[model samples]
Target: MTLVEGAGPRTGAPPEPLRRNREFLLLWSGASMSFLATRVTAVAYPLIVLWHTGSPLAMSVVSTAALLPLLLVQLPAGALVDRWDRRRLMLGCEAGRVLAVGSVALALAAGRVDVAHLAAVAFLESALAVFYRLAERGAVRNLVHPAHLPAALAQNEARGRAAGLLGQPGGVLLHSAARWLPFGFGVLGYLVSLVTLLFVRKDFQAERTAPARPGRLTGEVAEGMRWLWRQRFLRAALGYVAGTNVLFQMLALALILRIKEAGLPSATLAVVVGIGGVGGLGGALAGGRLQRLMSQRTLLIGGAVAWTLLIGAMALTARPVLLGALYAGTGFVGAVFNVAAAVYQVRITPDAFQGRVAATAGLIGSGTNALGSFAGGLLLTAWGALPTVRAIAAAMAVLALLAAVAPGLRGETAATPRTAEPVDPVEPTEKPVEPTEKPVEPTEKGEGDR
Candidate 1:
């Protein structure tokens, strides 16, 4: 893989910032709207499961089915992403999801939808989302200068949080109005995304040497896993996220049950949950600046600390407003952590390996989340809501503390530093270079700045 070089002499005037980059604008706007719609489905899916099956267990099962792709499909999908054109892969995934989710909408219109149907559609949509995300991650490096990676990723994070801030409540309210409404809009969003993707001018991925036929897939997957395993800091961060996701998923299930038992309307529960999204939105808007001030390590560990305190507080409160406040605090911290992590990952990973590395991290992180959903369902079934939430909150707090002290994560700088003097741009070539056996290590010189 070629190392990204700094900018060289421009043919005319200097290259414009991504703000005026038409291709990047199209990519960003499309993805922003699509993510918003996806969030709608994310919230609506659970609500539909609960409304139809009226079982927390059923909701969890459907959620697990949706997440199961992260566990099973991520590696293969990542390998394919590295092989395929990222723009095409993203386009295809978006198109596939449109069809899959639209089918659900149609079934609802005909009044023929069921839990089994929901599970199948959810699985298909989520699997597509995983591929779509990996392709997007892989494509970002190609869409802008290396110097702009942090800002681009931070903006992307903000886009997602904005979607969450609006979509979660919007989904619930729409579902309350009509079950099919969210999915119908989801179709429209994808259509917009598809058109925008068609108009993007730049290449979204670099060329790669095709691996020899037979055992390539397994080798590629193993390569990604090995790369991640060797990155001590990233691996530890993965563990931290995975652990927190488990408890958070459990907490979500418990919160739903608590609202139900309290006899609150679905809209009330939606508002409480949606309040967290506001914090997320605020955090995303600030993440670029925050990373400039704090080291990546600081952000990682500090986020852990914030989560521990916030979740612990959650255990002490049954009031919806108080719980909402705690959730918002956690979201704010989580958004910052996400931006830092994404920037670091993008900076450190080579273009050729981007898809695999992203997929590997996501596979492990999301696999844990899926397990959490399943365990949450069973735990809530056996122990009920309040006790289950308390126990899990305590566990998550202890784990966060452990992560803060973990050797891999404790000593790294908060943000990667950007280079000062510009260097020549590396030209794209078809010739294959020798693949390095050594894992890519973080440099003492930071590659991220405000």
Candidate 2:
């Protein structure tokens, strides 16, 4: 537990989790801060739009604009990441996002913000966010031992979910006090996130092997997609995850509206969501062990079925209390499902391939999410909320059955060798260190400019 300047006392136990994994800790802190702020943005984005425009579709456009950047930027950005210094890339991205979002906040405060400005800001921040996240995730293996990887990822998930729990509620509370409060809070969090990144020693950076010579950009991108495409287990897991996002999202969102329709108190809805958080914490913590016991394919397929059934049950139930109980149960399963997919994806993917492969997955995944949200809104508008929910449940059902039993997915475990599991999947008893140095060098001051 070596002291990291201004980082406060090490809250962790005496054993170093990633060997002298000080950089990983710093990176975690950086990512966690940014993610926490994003949660506030997540809340403020919709509420602010609603207050100004009085349209849910306007809010949906904001989400769509943010996501559209991924499809256009990810593959090219991934290729660029393979060529660039991942650390500098992340630094530039963080600094860029801070200004981008901060400028938007400033404009909003000045009463000059509009839909176009909001959309542009969302697009810019999301573009940087895509590359920054890819680099940061791509850097993980260089920072830690294979054994600590699983625990590290679990802790990351915990941070994200924890942020979601705290940030959303806090953002709402602040916005209730004042519309601009959340944006200000969001800016502060992003700044703190950027600042905390400075303490990490650069010598412990994630390393990349030299890229293949003479390969065309398009060819290299294809190679990565092909590698992942050939992996039955990974693709199958991706299928379930992709389907879950595409199919069940509307149902998930509709839960709140349903409670309102049934005359349930919004406070009771908060209690239900809080209960889901508890379940999520447990699931995230247990993710690795579960993966070890059951393959990702099994877990994903099972999780999908469980969530669909619970959602359908909620849709059928007349009582708000039972529906609320169902929400808690489904959230627990959903969290674990996410952990399973992410762990497997991270594990099977080679370190050199992380940036591109992850970007491809993220692009498709995010696009599907945007599409689902749009479709959900339109369907709910046309068919009414309850029937739209039933339609989503039907989609989830079809997705579950079609995806789980598909020929490509059914036997993925057969191809996976026990001894061949990537070192990233297993937890180590000791902190693992890189072979290049004895101890890490000192931290450097962050450059103020991009």
Candidate 3:
């Protein structure tokens, strides 16, 4: 077990089973609903634009608009969250998204919608969602006991994958009924999430006090970056994650093209994508066991290797069944990697640095993926999908190697109080009641995210 200095009772005993906590249950329920809404919005924006303009350029613009917020707002939003009460920040964000998306739903239902209007709403809604997610991530540690952190994070990730599966296709189906239906569904989900938050009673209490003299927000963010970068392990891990994400997007692009190239029907493609949700579910369930048995660094390397092999195999075989098999494996690896990374970060980060550190890493990571896709799009236009996919697969193999053999990065492990000082997690642990019990659960630890 990782030894923490001044361990608090809240951090010592195996965290109470997450599901047993009423406040956590309410929060989880709300998160699930909001995640589902995001998925629906993802599908609705593109489909609605395509239907209206029949202009591929118009569709592309909507995608660009939706993604801009993450690249621009994450660090500032994270800093702001740190300066305010996390729950209120989350609630306000949810309320804002609800109104932004609700306006679109009303406009569409009233026969007054247009592509420009839909894209503008999408931008505002996505921006609100970015801040909301940052606050939620920052507040998570306050909800569950320290020992239960892995399971709680795993469950959250599972809901995210579940939302993607249950919501996106469902959105498309509803859109068939009426283009406006999906937006209405998203608005309703946000409102439900807001109501759930209203009923939940939990506090995200931080012990850190801001400086008497205010520090520059940019300077604080830079401090987070400097600390992360100085730690060789963190730098390599971040690089590997960002590279893996780009490769994963490329693989996704390749699989779609390969399926179509093989003359598979749309239903077959849908089924393949839907089946990935099962793999995500399995990965989430397996995270607890994996953390105990595998080093965080090893988990990341192995997951990256697994994904690379699966994508490479798909590139070689273009058969629909082969593609599905590879996709399921890729999804499984991706989920496990995300779970391990997130928990690991929670274990390492000082509570004071949580919001800024998490957001800086998140924003940069997201930007890398976006940049990768943009590059891939250019590659596709110049050389087409197959070559670009093969190159992407090869690049992943190199990144996986970097994660495994990178020097100065081998010591990455769960945080020990010796390393992450000043900001303590959980209240201090009481003196041991009995020697026979370990107090801390060995099977559950290290939940990090990508």
Candidate 2's C-alpha runs over 4 A off are: 1-15, 18-20, 49-63, 108-111, 202-206, 211-216, 260-274, 374-404, 410-450
Clashing residue pairs found in predicted model 1? 295-414, 295-415, 296-413, 296-414, 296-415, 416-446, 416-447, 416-448, 417-446, 417-447
Give the top-scoring candidate (lDDT): 1
Per TM-score, the best of the predicted structures is: 3
Q: For residues 305-368, what per-residue lDDT tens digits would candidate 2 score against the true structure?
A: 7876787777687464566577767777776666656655655565556677788888778778
Give the residue spans of candidate 3 off by over 4 A: 1-15, 211-215, 378-389, 417-450
State candidate 2's TM-score: 0.78
The lDDT of model 1 is 0.74
lDDT of each: 0.74, 0.66, 0.72
Candidate 1 C-alpha lDDT tens digits along 1-450 = 122323322332343575766877889899887898888998889898889878999898888788788788999888788777789888898899889999999988887758888999889888888888899877776776554666678889989888877887789898999999999989988889989999999888765544424558998777767766766677777777788778878878888877776777776676667788778877876776576567776676677677767877766766778878888888888888788788777765556667788888887777777688899999889988777877876787687678767887763422222232222113222222222332232222323422
Give, for candidate 2, the lowest lDDT window spanning 10 residues.
Answer: 441-450
List, residue by residue over 114-163, the lDDT tens digit for candidate 3.
77887888888888888778777766777766655666777878888888
What RMSD does each model have against the real structure?
6.2, 9.2, 5.1
What is the number of residue pairs that collide in model 1? 10
Count of clashing pairs, candidate 3: 16
